[model samples]
Target: MLSTFILSQTKFDDVNELVKAGEFTKASKLIDEKVKTMNLLHEEIFQLQFEKERLERIRKDFNKTADDILKYARKYYPNATESDLRKWEDDGSLEYKIIDGKKWYFARAASNLFRINKEAKKQKELIDGFKKDPLDVFLESYTPKVLDESANAQEKLVKPVTFRLNYTVTVEPNAVPNGEVIRCWLPFPREGHERQQNIKLLGINSDEYVIASNDNLQRTIYFEKVAQKDQPTVFNIVLEVTNYSEVNFIEPTQIKPYNKNSGLYKTFTSERAPHIVFTDKIKNLSKEIVGEEKNPYLIAKKIFTWISTNIPWAGAREYSTIENISEYCLTRKHGDCGIKTLLFMTLCRYNGIPAKWQSGWMLHPGEVNLHDWCEIYLEGYGWVPVDQSFGMVDSEKEDEKYFFLGSIDPYHLIINDDYSTPIFPAKIFPRSETVDFQRGELEWRGGNLYFDKWDYHMEVEYIEPK
Candidate 1:
């Protein structure tokens, strides 16, 4: 699919405004009228259909009512008052929208409240006995080991850890009519990356499947299965990969100036619209945060530190719903992994730093989850990993605080070196995920089957080093 299209601009704008105003019914009608009367390009029609799909996706994300959120909050704060809820809402910690005069909360708003609000977290720990997340616990123990190993080793890469991963996507029973072909794109490990190597697909449940070529940035294993009545259609792949820890030892003095004419520098630093545009807000914020920093690494560090300190991580709405993720994150004052990473990339790019997206699964022992981070290119040092959402480490040593800035743990399962890139075999409809592809995507002759229509699960086993 084409990355962009030129629609009937003024009419499309009206539809967009209607969708934004929660006038989806009107928006749908207008879209149909345009298709019938306007000489629209196929791409424009495709875009319009997605605009309709966007409305449905938004409905799903913002399904909760005020009462629902309050009830959920009362789980930890049984005496939680309406005023407290209102306060959280004002702070943007509890995501909600005043849709057509009725307040609708993001589906994860109740769960994310504690994550974004410090007092709510304290209350939860006191009342619900909340503990540190397994992922945080694992990172505490694992990061230090990698840093120590990298500090001593002559080579930049250290502590190669191999894992056997089983990933499955199940389309809910009758998601489509029985015997209809369900097309699936499962997230498979990317090839030809130095840090991620020895990728071997052990097996797949389906007898026939096409593993996307190494060049597909968003690499996927495509499968086709017929839906069965009352039974979920399942697709899975078991694969073994050796993921290595990357520790690029850098010296401030040795950092080289970016070769301005280089294509890598040009492509990444320039604005990619809909998300990475260098808006006035971004330009000003970058100036405020960077503050006359000339060194490329230091400039990146400044942007990273500012986001780490200011933009607290919160659960994000679906990527497709938001027109501009980076700007949304800035306005909301919080975002999840990919949201923060997008903001990070935008700021870095605005400041002439070459930054791009990297994501997959972070398989840290028992703490496996869909994750996103980015890599920034330095002239002499090559590209370095930066997990902006992980934030700064609580340590006096600069290296410890900056470990993720230049290094990555072996727990990473690098699936996409970049975001919003093509899926091999070329999907016919808009992807279930317009941005990052982690959970996998499905569709049939009917159309795209969204996240609500299916479920995804990943299981991992550690292989002992020889």
Candidate 2:
């Protein structure tokens, strides 16, 4: 309503009228010129902020009816009952918001809990945890399908890949003011991130793009385009990166735990709130998982095994939407890569093991996925990769199972070592990805365009080994 009123006072209405008249190119050009001429005034900018704040206040004050909560829960867990959900809320496994003296929930919280949290309350057999019908897989696989024919074969299984890929982000036309300067931040690969190296900027489509400073925790190639009527604004980046297979063999005898007084140990070991905090439930679970274990390596192994056994891989809501991600996964029982990783990190940190976030994309010949995993800083052994969601499933390859616990194959394209860190040069509006920067962010002077208002496409082609 506020935006509708505000639109009445701006050139947007004129462009919109042109669009209705089938004068898109003219509307596009006219609005482009006007944006350069009349740029949004302070009052217009304030309205955008005001509207955003107003919506937030509504979100804060909204309360979910019992049926409302159950509605979301049943989508994920078909058999979930209101009583069962209330039991979760009663036990403090599910967190809720308060509005008008009633209990409410962030919808994602309700959904995540119904789907995954129930498992934390139940006990499962050891053999039931592994993935069924283990597929013969990637270079990341312990045994490769074409290891002998592959060039870059340093080990029995070799998977080396390079690619000149184009990633595109397009915002729905008319979502923002046509005259406003649309700003877009597309995900970019750092010069050398993990096994992904030789980052080269082949091109970007916009007239000017600022590849953020390399040190920015969540780096992006920022682009500015003048919004025009009737056509979606497009942003693109073409780049190349290569991944080499990585493996680590854990030798427990040589591991030395970190000193308690050191700052390095303190940083990762201590609790980080909103996601990685140690609640009573997490503390209790940590104690249970580490009942007789004193060694950091053994402690991590136990927690890793517990999570891999308990939490099965399932699609998850955006990290930004969840209040306590790790706890959500802990109580809900299933999560995607990121949710499981956060739960693993929080549990490890609670038990004096240091862990942190790492995510980007994973690529193999026919597959590419937006992925998240973690790195644990073990004494002497340094930082080791762990993917709890994809752990060793079958007992036959116990050594291979341990590979993901202490090491990761080199298929990772890590973009952020830390989650929720600010993008460089900063964004004037609230970030679309407040907790994690993966698909990237976009905004203009009037307001922000959310993921729903845009689409992101990632295309990859392997630079075959010579």
Q: Which one is best on TM-score?
A: 1
TM per candidate: 0.95, 0.72
Model 1, span 2-25: residue lDDT tens: 432212222467887876676767
Q: In candidate 1, how many clashes are counted? A: 0
Error of 1 at 73 (Å): 2.1
- After aligning candidate 1 to the native by TM-score, how far in Å is the CA of 172 from where it should be? 1.2
Error of 1 at 220 (Å): 1.1
lDDT of each: 0.85, 0.68
* Residue 204 Cα positional deviation in candidate 2, in Å, after optimal superposition: 0.9
- Clash list (residue pairs), candidate 1: none
Candidate 2, residue 306: how far the Cα is off, in Å: 0.7
User: Candidate 1: RMSD over Cα atoms?
Assistant: 2.1
